[model samples]
Target: GKAVFDATRPDEVRQFFDGLEPFDHLVLAASGGKGLGPFATLDLADIGSGVDEKIRPQLSCLQAALPTLNRSGSVTFISAVSAQLAAPGVAGIGAINGMLLTVAPILAVELKPLRVNVVAPGVIDTPWWDF
Candidate 1:
């Protein structure tokens, strides 16, 4: 069964896990279609936010799922290649991706036996790239 809850809302995120049975794995991928373009020309407000859309929500999910995510259950975060390559217009995406890469290891240490890992895929032929 799939339930729809706003990932941005801490309360909703918590309620979600509270409803789920003990699970095997938790995969956190790029959820929202954020990461607006051309860093220089884009709005600062757009890049500055998306805590629910980009980073903080992961923490919220982890915190909420701590109890339900069983021992040996893994948490995988799918980031972009921007973190490594640092291409021309990927400033915002790169920064956030880098942060995620940095935190995955720390989470692994903190949540021992939970098997945390990060997957950063290279440039995808997605609509986002149609700039």
Candidate 2:
């Protein structure tokens, strides 16, 4: 059976995490980050779309679960190199990446003693394309 995952639906998203145990680390990566890198750069619009619908929920859920995480655990978000590179149709991605970059620092500062880092990957071939 094929199950459709909708990030926009909070309940469905939450259900996905229902019985999952707390993790020492959380990684946020998307297929779009890899495919779009070579052709177009990231931009504000990309960021907005990337973060709002995709990244935010994961981040929010993790944050909500922080109390259960190891105090010294790390949280890592995979950003894109496009944050540094500029190209067409990338404004949204770039902005999102930039936000991720900023998020790490903010979390590190606010969650002092907790390590937070954003890995801005260049490109990677993943199963995301199959979707």
lDDT of each: 0.77, 0.62
Q: Each prediction's TM-score against the native?
A: 0.85, 0.68
Candidate 2 per-residue C-alpha lDDT over 44-130 given as tens digits, one digit per residue, 9 for 90 to 100: 354456666656765765555576556578777777776777766555556666777777788889886778888887766766546
Model 2: lDDT of residue 113: 75
Q: Which model scores highest in TM-score? A: 1
For model 1, the run of ten residues with the poorest summed lDDT: 43-52
Q: What are the runs in model 2 whose C-alpha is more than 4 Å off?
A: 1-8, 12-23, 30-48, 87-89, 129-131
The C-alpha stretches of model 1 lying farther than 4 A from their native spots are 125-131
lDDT tens string, model 1, 1-131? Answer: 87888778889999889998899898876444556467878655655564457677777888899998997789988777877875687776677677788999998998998999888888677875554
lDDT of 1 at 109: 91
Candidate 1: lDDT of 82?
78
Candidate 2 TM-score, true structure as reference: 0.68
Candidate topping lDDT = 1
